[model samples]
Target chain A: MSQGPVRKILLFVDGSEECITAAQYAVVLARTLGAELAALYVVNVSVLNELFKARIFIKMEQMDYEHDLEQDGRRYLNYISELGRAKGVSIETHIEKGVVNEVVVEKARILGADLLAMGELEPIKSRSDAFHDESELILRKAHCSVLVVKDADYIERLYQAME
Target chain B: MRISGLLSEKTISRLTRTDKQGVIEELLDLAMNSGQVHDREEALRAILAREALMSTGLEKGIAVPHAKTRAVSEITMALGVSEGGVDFHSADGKPSYIFFFLLAPENAAGPNVQVLAQIARLTHDRSFCEDLRKAESPAGMLAVINDAE
Candidate 1:
């Protein structure tokens, strides 16, 4: 049974290798569906805080890292836009600062996206890892239809065919 | 894009200027040497205008003074390290040590934003900042950036 037409798609990008494959697939899907695409990169503040708490990261001098992370997010979002451009699809880019999963879900809702796309996640090493896995959390929290793009080889072929 | 890729020893300098305006002009001259900027005066005016609106002096001894103008053909950047620290009217009221002078073509908004962000992220590292501060020469500064990248 079809849920409905997918007019808008929101893609979550993290600059991971897997996200590149996901981006290719997202571009292809958006092109095929004639859907408006928006790519978002969230600066995971919670992860930064976790590193700070664990002493893995030195104390932030004055929350300047947040601005840095925002810029980092823009860089990642720009990459997604490039991917979309290569496929002859136009993608709007957005950056947000927050817990990654929450931000992704909220953006999907706010965009009224019919579909949300993201990279394939790594295998959870343990139950705790699964519990904290951002992709898993996003899958649970997203109100729109979620698409996890795997099969990198096939997606690469699909993206290249668009050229 | 990586800031390291856009930077060269010729575009990196140990700034002798003690004031913000002098340091910015010094850096802009270095950027012009890269041959990416065609109109030096236009770029200077754009940067100063941006400064007039609000200081780009960020806290923690970092300042990125940037502008978009037709003067630059692409996203060009110059790195300056000031040992004496120049007052930029930063948010913390602290003098800024590292100066990233960026100029981009008016149309290249995407790469310009990405480059600015890359600079911010790299400078945010305390060790990176410390290493940059200690760089003795233009070549030394390039090496620090190379190692960081």
Candidate 2:
């Protein structure tokens, strides 16, 4: 079998259950392909800006909300990093503050990543309809190949087998 | 209500170094001299370890290199301005001119995160960043931060 040309992989994670499932697959792929892995968690600044403009949160309160979101991003990135470590796949973690799709694509390009991996999209609520949805936008505009994992159970099973 | 309250004149200065490690070291030295950080070596190690995990260089010529460690008693912040941009490996592929080095207690994650978010929000404005770059002295930098708030 000819070896794949993938040398670097970038994974976008948002701490969702589905994202965790996708992260498991990313780890396995990185280990199998001997590729360097990087995980990114964007703080979704555009959504926060909308909430601020809508006066849903006062200035001080908005700062607090942004802080909570960043903490969440850090936790999720750290979790993925740990998972990658356990499987002998070193994963670098990044916490970017910006629009989700834009940041993901920009980071991928900057890292010279060969492939971008993300979880399948969850149902969007009404409140999120106002902004550009990240999943579809990332798929359509990514500069590199993209892998969207839809089968959470299958990935989870593979992850468990590695333990 | 302004984040500038966290920064003192002594904690702000111009960075002469053109590399990320040297810049971080200089900022950490400033934090130590200000008596905000108890152990300089430990704080430097912690910050570098975090940097190794990910470059904190954001877009728009700004880099917020931060770490939550027990080396500091509180959330300590130091600002460095580099006239000749340093290679921070920012996502935009541009050199970073403004550097914010932050050290916080492990238990103060909430406030630490808030300070980072506040810095990000403030620097997102191109005008504000321009003013920050023009400020030549530590007091000038503080004034820019205060005026922006």
Candidate 3:
């Protein structure tokens, strides 16, 4: 008998605080559908320039705490891997040095992933309520189905239900 | 402003004060130091109060927690480099690196969108994030950001 199309999930990570939100969603989806998780990080190599002078921007008494936005990506991927291992889910990670949306979508296509999970870059503070939201701009433009997660709670709901 | 609006390189950790209280304190400090905010405590409370409503953590090792304030005359930004990443409670479950502690007057919405779009443009580049991590010093990090702009 013929089988349905395979459902692979692609996650875009940027070492931003929001990645945590993206991972939560991807992890639950991976566990439920028994799909594989592919984590990818796009490394931007242009932060080391001189004209920008945007580095070493802060410190505590001459100590170098230059942000390690890239190194932390590996650490995060490890965390995702651990979460997957514990859940008995298959997980894979890819770190590419390029643009964020382009590399993420490209990686997903190369892997034939069906879904893309990502977090917001910034949040909007309004009088009504503060919104933790990602740009629907990228989501709408993505080739595959995009699941933009605003809250980390959605993942918890899945875990609670699964349990 | 060559082009991009990222902040000073990563630091050992300024918001050394962890927790929600600490984050609010640091954000207040940033907004004030930015000269855009008139009152540190007020701005801090504003940002923290917003966070209490919902965490700004976006998931993927980044968080953009901010608040609206009448104190700020224009949109101002600050960079909080955390050595010991905080538990921002991001959706993906990771810490933050490049924090854009944004503050603007309650009235201006255009500048807010302009800055957000700029931030999005920066993240859109992966090599930029890679270079950000590779940077060992503040100058190195700034150099990368400048070139990207």
**Residue B143, candidate 2: C-alpha displacement in angstroms:** 53
Give me the runs in candidate 3 sitting further than 4 Å from their true place. A1-6, A46-67, A124-137, A160-163, B1-149
Tell me the tens digit of each residue's lDDT in model 3 across B15-126: 5655746765675565565455677667777777767766666544456666667767777676555666777776567776555567666654334534544554565577
Where in model 1 is the C-alpha error above 4 Å?
A1-163
- Report the TM-score for the A-chain of model 3: 0.71
Whole-model alpha-carbon lDDT for candidate 2:
0.80
Candidate 1's residue-wise lDDT over B36-65, tens digit each? 899889999999987876678887998888
TM-score of each: 0.58, 0.51, 0.44
User: Per-residue lDDT tens digits of candidate 2, residues A29-73?
Assistant: 888887888999988776667544432233654565578778888
Q: Itemize residue pairs with steric clashes in candidate 1.
A: none
Candidate that beats the other on lDDT, 2 or 3, i.e. the better one: 2
Q: How accurately is candidate 3 docked according to DockQ?
A: 0.03
TM-score of chain A of 1: 0.88
Docking class of predicted structure 1: incorrect
Q: What digit string (tens of lDDT, one per residue) describes model 2 on residues B1-149? A: 24687889988999998888899999998777668788888999998887776677777788888776789888888999999899998767899999888888875544554466567667778998999999979999999988776
lDDT of 3 at B144: 66
Off by over 4 Å in 2: A1-3, A124-131, B1-149
Pick the winner on TM-score between candidates 1 and 3. Answer: 1
True contacts kept of 1: 0.00
